[model samples]
Target: MDDSALLQFSRQILLPEFGIAGQTRLSDGCVVIVGLGGLGSAAAMYLAAAGVGKLILLDDDVVDLSNLQRQIAHDVNHIGILKVFSARDRLLALNPSCEVVAQPVRFVAHQADAWLAEADLVLDCCDNFATRFALNQVCCSAQIPLVSGAALGWSGQVCVFLYQSGQACYRCLFADHPESAATCSEHGIMSPLVGVIGSLQALEALKVLAQVGDTLHSRLLLFDGLHQTWRTVQVSADPACPVCSAADSP
Candidate 1:
């Protein structure tokens, strides 16, 4: 590591848990973020700021007036631009040293293998259950740690799936995607609520990357912004879970 780099992260290096070694590990790590909305916006920003070496961002949507309410990664001026491109510019502006790869295309299961294989860690910030399930399957197969988060209205949840340890994947939690559910756009979301969940998602991702604290593996953290309460629910691997079962086999 260069002397200037070390000096730049002097404050982080001072922490016993994240000394020079941990900082170096982070600097060399690669993280892939799917979706450039509320959750992705916050997670990507922090990861870049923390000196992650490489970031791969995926999002096919374009920024809109509504996105400015909570998608801090993009500003009003970026409206109509592809979300991935907007996020790339913002991250680069925050930390030019960090390499940002923008993929302004919708993520599909067929391409999950390549993306997950290349990432040291993956964050699922997508809006739909289909994408979330697809990402979970790919991450489980790749044995890559996946940090998943979701926000709807005033509630959100986050969890880390470490399939390498025979833990429950996202599919284990929700066997089938709910056919009827309200989205942030339909039901409306509290601007700050996304920030709370997104920030926590970023925290979980950092913890997983730095190996600093006990991760949320095998537990679901549910946050109720209106009630101002956080609840943890223990999750167990389903014996019949096709994805996790195959992951454990061989």
Candidate 2:
């Protein structure tokens, strides 16, 4: 590492667990984040500041006045601009050395193979189940690590799934998508609630990148902001789960 690089992340490097080696690992890792909204905003910011070498941001939406309340990565000047473009700009401003690849299109099932194949880790900060399921399927097929999170109202949940570990995936926990899944827009959300969950998501991603510590894999973390409590539920692989079944079949 160069003098400037070491000086930039001196605090992180001072830690025994994350000494120069761990910092170097992070500088060589590539993480793909599939959203630029509430959760994505926080995750991307932290990953960039922590010196993740490469980041691929995928989002199809445009910045709006409403997003400013929770989406910290964007500003008033970014209104009407593609989220991926705006987020990449913000991330570069934080760490110019980090490489940012902006994909300004919706991630669909058909394109999953290509994206998941390229990423070292996948962070699912998306809101809808369709997108989540599609990404999960791709990760399972590619045998990649996935850090997933969701938030609505004052509640949030986060989990990690590694296909190679023979652990349960998001599908195994919630077999079917809810017919009436509430969104932050309709039901409203506490801004800081997203920050809490997003920070947890970043922590999980860092663990995956560093290949250290016990992660949320095989378990689900549920956070209730109103009650200020956290609960962990064991997750087991389901033989009937289509994604896991396919992963284990061959």
Candidate 3:
């Protein structure tokens, strides 16, 4: 940690729990962020600013005009460009020392394991249940920590799964996809809602990496932006969950 580096993270290092040690951990951490949309936009920026050593950005989509409403990392200039590249450029601008790897690809079942091979933590900011379920399964099997966040229609939710024995994996909460899943285009989403959830995801990821403070581990946090209220509930491991059941976890 040089003088400039210390000065750059001085505010964070000032926290008693964080200090120099936590800052060091953050400077050495590597996080994989799936999805460079609204959620990933916020999470990735904060993580990069906080000095996470490396970030792997994954997203197969291209930036569109409609995305400007919430996706903060990209601008009009980035329209039609791959989301991963757009976010990578922003993250690098935030912290030049941070190594940014941009992968213009979606998270799929087959690539999950390989993508996360070197990840110290993963931020699940992607939409859709299939990717979420696959990420949960791979993270659980590998015993890696996962921070998942979702935002849709003035509401959002976040959960942290440490993948420890008895902890709740994502599949433990949503075993199957709903018959009528809402679409962002149809239902609409608030610009700030995803920011809130994404920021929380970043916070939880930092805590997990720095080993400081109580994270959202084994807990689900729900935010109702319309009502301006927050709720939290304990999540337990599903004994029969095929993804994280005792029989399946190593």
TM-score, per-candidate, Cα-based: 0.96, 0.97, 0.97
Cα-based lDDT for every prediction: 0.88, 0.90, 0.92
Please tell me which predicted candidate would have the highest lDDT against the true structure. Answer: 3
Cα deviation at 36, candidate 2, in Å, is: 0.5
Tens digits of per-residue lDDT for model 1 on 19-138?
A: 988788788889999999998999899888888889999999999999999999999889999999999999999888899999988889997777666698998998998888889888
Query: For model 3, how big is the CA root-mean-square deviation?
Result: 1.2
Give lDDT: candidate 1, residue 153: 88
Model 2: lDDT equals 0.90
User: Model 3: how far is 86 from its true place, Å?
Assistant: 1.0
Tens digit per residue, CA lDDT, model 3, 90-145: 99999999999999888987877788888999999998887888888888878889
Pairs that collide in candidate 2 are none
Instruction: List where candidate 3 sits over 4 angstroms from the true fold.
Output: 246-250
What is candidate 3's local distance difference test score?
Answer: 0.92
lDDT of each residue in 150-235, candidate 2, tens digit only? 99889999999998656898788889888777788899988888788888999999888987788999999999999999999998
Clashing pairs in 3: none
Report the lDDT of model 1 for residue 235.
96
